[model samples]
Target: MDAGGEEAKQERHLVLAHKLFLLSHPDLDDLAKVALRSDALDAVKSDGMAPLFESLAAAGVLEPDDALLAEMRARIDEEVRKLDEKIADAEENLGESEVREAHLAKSLYFMRVGEKEKALEQLKVTEGKTVAVGQKMDLVFYTLQIGLFYMDFDLISKSIDKAKNLFEEGGDWERKNRLKVYEGLYFMATRNFKKAASLFLDSISTFTTYELFPYDTFVFYTVITSIITLDRVSLKQKVVDAPEILAVIGKVPHLSEFLNSLYNCQYKSFFVAFSGMTEQIKLDRYLQPHFRYYMREVRTVVYSQFLESYKSVTMEAMAAAFGVTVDFIDQELSRFIAAGKLHCKIDKVAGVLETNRPDARNAFYQATIKQGDFLLNRIQKLSRVIDL
Candidate 1:
């Protein structure tokens, strides 16, 4: 990345962090206003975020400042003029690479100023001049950053596909690893935890995408997604014992205990860690919408793990094992059982829970049957096309 690209990446993260802070601290209006004016406005101004500025003003998050807006416009115009001059000179007298560099500089400028449509247009122009697979991938990465910053799923999805296609043409290992983080974040934001978990775990040791987030945040996502997606055995091996995760997991509050307690079957401690993790989840823009779903999934995992141990157990004993009251356990079990999330029956009269656990063979058979059905449908479609 060039200086402009690096600055653009940093500014993108800073702006996103500020917006996320405002989202999570709605009650602290005065503080938000101060932070916006003091810390964010300069960057916003440089980025020429007129719509964002007006939106904040309309929302009363910031007072309207005509002078700042004027200054922002003036600065943008001046910088764009210089870029055009450079591009024109390069086209007139310079070689192909110089012209390509000039065009890329202009594209990066548009990206830095948060001009999404212009940035994409200019990037396409730059891509037209680029021949190397690596350079094309870099362009895709820039597009991905813009998509992520704006939370534009369509753009993000398309960019990710484009990056993968370019990688097929040939890309370096570092860029490939970086793409995994980008794809993981997209999957996570789109509520596909299984795919996200796979991608995050793959990139854990090779995580160099600091522009997206820090190592701690990466580990946090890895742990959170793995807990819901990975089996206990895999979780123990990949997350609980992984050196990359072990190194930074403790830095994120409640996260270490959250992963370890569940793996260790310490239900009470797990619950405490889980409770602490929820506040952070609620504060996150991507995770907040899925909070209820995540809560249900985590509960299902823990409940299923507990029930896997025995054929039958007293309700009181199960409750005590989780450090909860008998009534609480009974209610929780009844809800999960009714929802078909847990394969157990509660014997209210005897205060015993009987597990109806499926055998491994049976589960595999069911999975095979479903897959066979899917394959048959696809084959029938192919036969029809052949007949036609």
Candidate 2:
């Protein structure tokens, strides 16, 4: 063989060996360390394995270096440029389908580098093209991902609707499960906690049946949203106590502690657990939208419990129990009272909040009105029947 052929063979062998090594070492960090030590990455560099390098960078197995990243990006850009030219040539000779595949591959590369806008532009080209069910699913997946990352609920909803039909028709169980997750995320974004929690729970079951990516993320959302939307008993029965969920919860200590506090009604403990992770919760893409609402719901539960336990509690004592200032407690109490959530009277001067149970007279009046409405409806129906 010529020297060029011999060099190509060596590069191919090196790439194969690298793949085998990665397969043997499941841990990306461990593989990265070994690959670096053995000069395996260097051997494969000649083959222009941009995707491999990109994966390493994404996995944090390769430390961040600005110059190195820029160089890699430049190389990938050059490769994409070449591919664009090939795609143009193939459009006439190869076929439209082949050209669409090229566009998708390029779009994927852009997506990996976080250039979602460019990826989206590429996806737009392939959107209405005739493609296989699997390719159609890929299109839908990327569309939803772009919509979600950008916080465009309309786009996300549209993508889900489009994919739902395809997945249902194709009977793609795995992708359908993924669609559930995206739907859950959409509901969460919209602040529909009940629907979001239910969808997450259903998705968790599907995930258990067929191992899915980002399993731990789904578990976190499921636990947090369930706490907000479900009572203690329902949460325990459906989520916290589930064996599959428990296994996943073991991986997230913060979530585990939060769940424990919520289940035990340890208000102070729950606050501490939640406050410690406040920044992380805010930064999470999926959790940020619901965090404030969840916190309010938790406080409502805690305050309601307090009201039930005591006929009247001083603002100072309430503040102390909740680890907040008296002024904060007063303000929250006023807001709750205004919203009719807390049936209580607040004495600003005395700094006491007096709980007011529903008056028996008011209950009787409400029941009487409800019964009168029912009787009126029955009489009208009977009159109509007699006329008939």
Candidate 3:
């Protein structure tokens, strides 16, 4: 073969090798090296491999050397500028390749700087384009990624539905797992802890079985949802006792402390630990929505435990112990009492909350009445059946 042909063949081999390595390996350092080498060999101005480099840079896999990163960014910007010119010049049909590359460049840059809305806006440019199957899939994934990064649950749901329609036969396992993760996140955002926990556990199983890199995230969410839902046994079984989860939990001290306090039933300690990490928790996009509700649920558990331990406690003492105003305690207790969640009576004049246990006689009478109602309903159903 001619020298030019041989060099082209070599470039193709390198790009293919790099893509294969990314598919199999989860090591960022190794992937960075492959991406750099591939970019060096394919030294074209508007290289198609820009997306691959963009992915690595966004993931922080590239070297932290500022000079190198700056150069990379400059080149990407130049390429995108050229693509914009080409798009503007085309009258009828914008070339698919040029449009996709421009979209990817702008979206990646916006995402790197945490401008999720701009990233999403860039993605929308290609929404109505006539693209190949692979590009269509990329658009779907990018839409979902931007939606998730910004905690846009509505957009996330729409993207998932679009993905389902685009790949109706269920696509690959990786895509299915990604959809499951988003579904779980939606449930988490909506405060449906039980359903969220179940979906996260399923995603964790899929990730573990596939040896995926992001199973840790699913594990963390599973534990968080389980805790809020008061399913400590499941949390222990699915997270605390699992070796994989244990390994990852050590990396997040806040989570570890929260779990420890929960397991030990140190309600005050748990709140203290959580309060200390409030700023950090608020910064997490996925966890922010659940913060206020989870705190309220934890407080409920603490109050219920306190009530169980005392026949009658002064509202002032309870408020002081919980570090809240007496009025606040009164309001919360009133809510619980009205909802029938707490079997207690508040004596406003005495400023005491008196615990009430079900009397055996009253319980027996209620059970008898319930059984009679059930029998009457069954007889009515049988009478209707006979007439039919």
Candidate 4:
């Protein structure tokens, strides 16, 4: 081949090889690397991590640092440590809730790598403790952080219940409102419209004091703070928008349900200027909180009503879902008889009570919708336990 043609061919081959490298690795390929570097400086700005700054400089995202960088990192670390102490103190007052979950959730990326047992341990510790207002809130926030960071569903649900409980009990309005953001994250994690909308409204109402508050209720403050740091970069490429990130927030399987809960909390954040219409008048101010409370009740009742079905589904699965005594479920079965909601019989042949209802010949749906409603009412007052 001619020299010129050979050179051109070599360039094309190199480009093709690079493309192939990206395609071969499904996760964290070249494109992701580029995107990650682009966002690195933002992390430094947003989170002010000495490690992140040092890492970014190493990655060529920013210029090498000097003593000033060390000083900055030190200051940031001190501030971060103080925040951590505040969280710890708040939880200690309630029974060291933050510590209960400290090991449970380290960070998002770590959790995605998979650590369900640690996260679950945090849940047990928190459950064993008692919490008052400040400490209770601290514990709730710790739970929120671990739940969102690690995407732990049980933690998310329990924390949501705790936050709403404190809010209803007249906990610090601002903090409770902040927890609404965490609550929104849970809904967002789940993609449940009703909960997300309510959480968003709660976040909006509490914005005036969000800055003064340092807690996990506002899960994405880190991301927001990160992006703002990237603002000074002399680069503008419509690579992705905020909404796009938020959209992707809901689909990450491990984080989906948790994200739905968060979405339910922040999808309608009014504190950011809703519509800018002078006379439009906000609807959520009165309607949203009350409605959220109503939904919470309904869900609890529905869960209770499904107790029989749940036991039949899988003992292990039900235990994971409800976060309460399986024995309690068994104990509650007798209650169903009084309500005319449960019936048991011996099937002489297969020798099983058949709660799953798989028997074709002697099978029946036994419980009427009315009986379901009766049982549902028993657990209907769950508003104080879960937000939505």
Most TM-score-accurate candidate: 1
Clashing pairs in 1: none
Model 3, residue 267: what's the lDDT?
56
Better of 2 and 3 by TM-score: 2
lDDT of 3 by residue, 1-388 (tens): 1324333433232234334334334333665666654554343223433444455446664433445545656765775677567556553365666666655666665554444566677777766553564466667776765564445678878887887786774366666676676667777867788888777777765553111114444566777777666555766787667676676665555777777776666655766767755644454455565667676675666567678778999999888776678998999999878877788999999999999956789999999999999999999999999999
Candidate 1, residue 385: how far the Cα is off, in Å: 26
Candidate number with the higher TM-score (1 or 2) = 1
**What local distance difference test score does each model get?**
0.85, 0.70, 0.63, 0.43
TM-score of 2: 0.66
Summarize candidate 1's per-residue lDDT along 1-388 as a digit string, tens digits.
Answer: 1334543555364455546455446544675557656666665665687656677667765679888767776777899899999999999999999999999999998887767799899999999999999999989988988887778899999999989888888899999999999999999999999999999999988988878866787789999999999998899899999998888788789999999999899999999999999988876767877989999999999999988998999998888888889999989888988999999998899999999977999989999999999999999999999999
Measured over all alpha carbons after superposition, the RMSD of each candidate to the real structure, in angstroms, is: 5.5, 10.9, 12.7, 22.6
User: Per-residue lDDT for 1-388 in model 2, tens only?
Assistant: 1324333433233234334344344334664556553464453254444555566556764444556656766887797898798778778788887888777777776655456577788787776564678778878777776675456788888888888788766846777777787788788878887898998898776763121225665677788778778876788799878886887686665788778876776667877878865655564655565767667776676678677778888888878876778888888888888888788899988888898978799999999999999999999999999999
TM agreement with the true structure for every prediction: 0.87, 0.66, 0.56, 0.30
Residue runs of model 1 more than 4 Å from their true location after superposition: 1-11, 14-18, 24-38, 46-48, 362-388
Candidates 1 and 2: which is better by lDDT?
Answer: 1
Residue 294's lDDT within candidate 4 is 35
The per-residue C-alpha lDDT of model 4 at residue 233 equals: 23
Clashes of 2: 0
In candidate 3, how many Å is residue 346 off? 4.6
Q: What is the number of backbone collisions in each predicted candidate, taken in the order shown?
A: 0, 0, 0, 32
Whose lDDT is higher: candidate 2's or candidate 3's?
2
